[model samples]
Target: MLTYTPAVQHAQPPASERPWLLLLLAFVWLWPGVFAHDLWAPMEPQLLTVIEQWRNGGHWALPTLFDRPYWEAAPVYVWLGAASQAVFSPWLLDAYEAVRLVNVGLMAIGFCCIGGAARQFLGRRFGRTAVLVLIGCPGLLMPAHLMSTIPLLFTGAAMCFYGLSLAKARVIMASLMLGGGWVLLALSGSLLLSLSLMLLGACLPLSPHWRYRRYYLVLPTALLWAWPQMLLWPYALYQADTAAFFSWWQQQALMPFGGFGQIQFDFSLWYYLKNLLWFAFPAWPLAIWSASRLRLADSDWGILGMAWLALLGFLLAVSPLQFQDLLVILLPPLAVFGAAKLDALRRGAAAFLNWFGIMTFGLLALFLWLGFAAMNYGWPLKLAERAVYFSPYYQTDVDYFPILVACVFTPLWLWAITRQHVRGRQAVTNWAAGITLSWSLLLTLFLPWLDAAKSQRPVVQQMQKAFDADAVRRLQAGQECVSVEAGNHTARIAWQQYGWLTLDVDNPHCRYRLVRRSPQATTPAAGWQELWAGARPREKREWLALWQRLPAKPTEPAKTLQ
Candidate 1:
């Protein structure tokens, strides 16, 4: 039998390359994609809407969108975002931008906790490698930068890992982390995940490696710490409004389990497995190699990591899978497990990863540059035409600052990659650098174009123009409210934010109504006249149309009385 060796036995890097330096690099990697852009569609706007509602004196216990209770998740993340916005939006940032800062903080916490876990499990030096593996994950990049609860969820999971790693030696600290992580997972709108972690903690004693006297205190201590926090929000919400509480309970707690029965036994069950190919990437390959070499009983941390991965994988398999559902939970365990065996990685594999990152990102960055040139200069006629095809209304203007930034980073990336040696940690570092460089280039070079395509500001602006023209015809002044019919939450929020229009979906008496429809769909339903029709520049199918209620024909004079 092949014997397993602790990762601490491997040669360590110089003191100059410390975990703090890796964290600093991670901070740099996190900021660019976050700061420069407006909230992009599908999720960011929805989160902002919830925060806006809360800020506008909506009840803290129940999160509402356009005055309707939204019970998809708990309001913990929304509350945090509201506080962040309140603190920062006054002077430093826009509302959405301010909320996004929470993402940065959550990711920072996640990095630290995961690094701490790695240090406990593998060795002191392996912490940096674990963090690098996480930073390099393609799955983490977009979600981490967005205004979503997933980052909080990721942080919570990282805390659980860190707490689990500390169970044998630091019982009190481990219990607190475990319990606190459970609360975070619950509050972040995933009760199921919180429960899973709790169960995982309870089962730890069953493992031969973790059957120590101190380990038994972990779960009960975690539970004692967690129960009050877990109940506090729900109980307050219930006391505030029973109906809304039940709605939230049904959706948040009961619905996840109910959803499993609804899932068909189809190819969709393999969703995480399929996406793991690109989502987990470098980490998954390394984790598989590590797992292959080590027995389940080899290390307590290894057992815990594997169990956590399996539990999450099973949960994801049975439950419905959306793009955002994968979050950062899956990556940290993989990183911990993978980082342990970094030195054991064969030379050819390390070199391949290094070159693969270089070649892939090198070409991608080159293409992104070309696309930017096409957007600004129309130098490459074909690519320029494609750009125009996507965003017809987007005008060509050179933003020299982003261009300069991208210009500097491109050569810097080339320099960094060329100088790096093909060692295990170096390979992972190269991958992380490549991801950061590519994402930075996209956010910098293509930000304007991306914003043009994704932002609802332009769409709302067009609707505003039409509404203004109609308002002028009616000789109305000041802001006028409009009722929305069939308009999505995104459009409703966008109208209020950009167009400064008060939207009441429940108001039947409002004169104007906004309707959303596919481009191929027929006219608005009877009694409303279409005033304006438009969609985002890149939106090919769906469009929003502004309509005014046709004035009720004056009742015919009472001829019968005459």
Candidate 2:
């Protein structure tokens, strides 16, 4: 018989060495980018638009964008965002910033749940190690701080994993967690993903490592708790608005299976596989090393992690891939597996990772600082010129506060790497700290420039200026509604929110029309005089144009007199 010993059976560390302080610092590092910038284009603005619709007396059960029901996902994140805005907008925060606070809370929950799961499986210290592994991932950085449902999805997965970890010992608690996690997954808006996870839960007993009788409680508890909670939202939505509910149901039912017919199967399969190279980063290599040290049937945690990873990887391979979706679902199991046997990692591999992190982040920090200097002081004329080339409208303004913060972060990172003994866990810790430092530098030292490139506020302002000039010429006062044609959700949201312009895209009576097009594209249907044309400073191929309808040239007076 092959004997298996759990890592938790090893000797415990002293209380002083607990990771509370490090976890706290990691969380603090996550705070800067969340609140320090304007809502960026593409995703953030789209989410904000939905929350705005909810807050502006739209149906609470249905998240709408531009007064139409948006069923791309469930309304859980939107509901939280709306609540956050309502709570914080009254006092000190902008609506967008307030809404983003949800990301922070969700991320914290995810970290804690992952840590808890890791502790149950590996040991106390490995819990912290797992969290650090997750924190160190390059892929987790952006999604963890974004205002989206991704964090919710991540937290839900973590909760389920933690529940699975508890199944051998704490059956009732595990049942609760499994049930709650299933509901959370459902709420995060992918029914297929939620059901896949549920299927994993069901098959837990089939694994030789998880054949405990208590494991049977998981599926029953999930059915009792999760099924009803999952149905509750749809039922409530149905009662509130039947049409909106049907739209949501149709989308939920069709989205996963429907897109397969259109997608390139080969490309879709390779997408996540290739992205895993950079996305999971250091964690994936560590996970591979950790997996090599264990047998599949030896540890329950191993079986669970491997099964979860396989299931999620398969899902990503077959489905249309979004980086956020892949990152949130895959990172937890990767983190757990990565940290499972760090102490057993070969010395050469640990040292390589240690030095690699130091060298990589050190060079990246140096480059970022150089760019910062170039943008502010014109020290490197070439870099300065390149910066201007990227964002021509960006003005160089030196804010000493961010500079001071960057300076502190750099020295602190150096101190951390130098002070740590180059063991496996310590190496991972250094990597996590380096990631935090680099992200901090980007958010702080480079935020203004990045905001200049990414934010649509400037574009909206330029349009406002043009609209004002038009108003002056026409002797018209007050804000006029603009009809948008072929414009994206980002532009529409930015214009309406920042410019305070009423948008009625369907109203033919509106005199002003805003259109988005390629730079080379001709005017959209003539009879309209161009009033404004502009794009974001960093946008190269596409631009927005405002057009005013010309009055019908007085109808030529009916062919004159006899």
Candidate 3:
């Protein structure tokens, strides 16, 4: 017997690594109530109304906002919202809650896709790391929870990559993914062009079984059913509407593909980087490092991810990228790039990351908690004052339910901190755990305040009340409804909120009129008596002007109001 030393196998990992449980717990922590917060200004309300119009009309093609076709091409979320609204309409107070829950579900699915793909390419250790990169980014917080196209776009990007990963091994699944993923991308408003371009990018990165992929791609193309089958939501405008469409599109995509035009776009390269500096966070720094070592990264997935990064950059550079657009361009590839180098994290990097996460999120949680305590318990004098000043109308309510939920989750997050075995000893462990805590506390403890400050309800109510204490009564008594023009997105939101009291959406000569701009800057062509004017102080641009017609002049037509 040659030294029969009993080879002791290291203690086996748990029977179930419990991927589903971890993912679910993460979601539970990060995912807030759909109706817990308000539809924020700038994007949320505008997008909300677009979806509302879609569901209200029951037509498939994207509806026009104000009068022009929205042409966002982000129909997946709208369709999902419509479907969920159909199911939850009778019961739910806010149909957006259903749409929101669907968002959470899709979000969870996207996490699964990221983890699954990471497990295959980068191995089990980095699969969890991928999730950390996603949630830890501070920028993702608002965008992640928002009722906008970004959620689906982010999730779809993950699916597109995962589908690419499965292309070789699971041809049927790959075809389904490629087809379905591209369609979802196209449906995500104004991304159809991006979709077609990315498809070409996907093709350039060749792996084995190249011949089989052509067939895979072909099959999915059929499933797209671009024009004919899309009649369910057939929302495109006619050739006559081309001028308006291009005009709107031009605003967002300034000097787009500028090489084709004499108008050379600077691309705001520095500005884009500045935004990414904080928005992209550790992933941005880590991605830069990973990009430096691309040659040494895992063979196929690394290159494929790099290709995506290149494409996204090209698009962002060429187009006038909005801040929201970063969710699509920077994040997904950052996760991939970060995941590729997970195992290679030096002890120093790990320690830095651990401390960075611990501080960034830990302080965030503390500040949020302080704010909550200040509001509910009136502990901190200064913080409480600020909170009150910001949202004076936000009354404190001791809601037992969210408090109870927070009590459970607060300890759960603390437990997670100690339970290293649960998520593993990866560098990203602390960041993920910290973010989850921050999300949980913010949603549960600080939600009421957020709803007060952010929701359009108070703003709309105040504006209405300012007009007259019984303005609603006057409108309800079959009197003239207020005249509202489809102004900018901000005013459109107010218009939608106050639409019920309106005499007619198209009416201009109506006695009571709602003008978006200040009365002094531009008054009605027919002189008007300014009834009441106020604005949500939070947004300087939103100046709500309510006017009563002085007298009608023959020269002032409804079109003149334009």
Candidate 4:
């Protein structure tokens, strides 16, 4: 067995060489803020809605989405999301920030682990290169957003991988990592559980320790870790009927049909390859040549590479659901490969890589410019008028940003071919990688400005205006803590963010009050009022009638017994 130490310790870079590492670290921390100004908005409406239902003495049963009973989504994420809200009851900022911040922290930890672990498995120089590729990979960069659980999922997996590297040391510790990882996967859902366990079993050699020891500690620890979450699983299941509980996952699986499926297949598969090429850009040809130069049979890192590829293949094959973000799981291993190939590049192979890196940045800048130009200057004008200011002949559309960005690197690519005639290559490759890193930093930082130009819906802003704390408190103080009726999810978000007692809706939460808003219904208790408004005639009439019948606000507080 081979032993490895930290890269910083074994091969310390000069003080001047530290800027790239610092830049990567800084971006890792700030990346989430770029794409998502209101990171929690998309999830808040559903989760807060469910939480309000639970607080109203509702049974924790089938999950609900947008107020309707939704089953397929496992309760783990919902539970955690609600817990964050619960802790900071009556104020959502803390809870919202907590979930997003945790994810950001997790991404940083995962990146560092990949770098350190790669150094141990590969070599110091290769590990450094791997770290650079890991940071710069578009596949890894885009999904740092907090809306998804991929960050958590990747962090858990990284922990397991890094721990496996330590198996020769205390078996208990290594097994603990594996166990914790499996618990996370299980909580995530059956799909993740199946995939993770399959990979672990395939990659790991079955130890006599696990098989023979009646005193084994790993399994027990895992059970202990999972017990709390699993306790809620049965309750949720009992509450959900046969058809309602599995609906969310089924919906997720089926959503890939038609045009979306074709787009996903192309982007998820080809993008991963393209992302790798861009990460190493000007250095790519030499890296590829270097890779071709080596025989895998002699490479110590070969098994790890194969394992990484296998996991990626398995994920894509089995996921009835797929997205570009899901491909992040493949990044660490690819980083290792890229780094190793870079290490193999000779000193003469430089000019090509440098020019390539420069062009990569130049292209990225152009994309950024076009995205703005279309949104502000182009879209506002009539089509013919817009053509006067832009390249009208091609019917140039802004959505072609991806293609244009890809094209921008054409110059570096041309220079790369011509570099075969040049003698000095070392200076070029290093300068190119450095400049590319700078471009990545600038592009990511400027992402926030670009988001303003995109015409994405303002979901968070709408919620911010809709939630009213005082109204929610009055409602909670006046009515039953839980109420189930139409418009519960909307009510729940209003209540939870404002500290109202949860009224039951057939949301993710269990206990709910039954309320009817029809015209024939009796008057509401004091302080009760109808809040929903829409264009539907009958529902609108019902809401108006409910508004008139709402019970008067209570003036006196109810006495409580000690």
Q: Report, for every candidate in turn, its global Cα lDDT versus the true structure.
A: 0.79, 0.78, 0.64, 0.47
Model 4, span 215-235: residue lDDT tens? 144445544654555445644
Off by over 4 Å in 2: 1-18, 258-267, 321-324, 467-481, 486-488, 522-524, 551-562
Q: How well does candidate 3 score on lDDT at residue 193?
A: 41
* Best-to-worst ranking by lDDT: 1, 2, 3, 4
Each candidate's number of clashing pairs is 0, 0, 15, 25
Best by lDDT: 1
Task: Predict model 1's lDDT versus the native.
Answer: 0.79
TM-scores for the candidates: 0.90, 0.91, 0.81, 0.55
Report the alpha-carbon TM-score of model 2 versus the true structure: 0.91
- The candidate 4 region of ten consecutive residues with least summed lDDT is 452-461
**Residue 473 in candidate 4 has what lDDT?**
60
Q: RMSD of each candidate? A: 5.0, 5.1, 6.6, 14.3
- Tens-digit lDDT track of model 1 for 147-180: 7777878889998888888887799999999888
Q: What's the candidate order when arranged by decreasing TM-score? A: 2, 1, 3, 4
Q: How displaced is residue 279 in candidate 3, in Å?
A: 2.8
The TM-score obtained by model 4 is 0.55
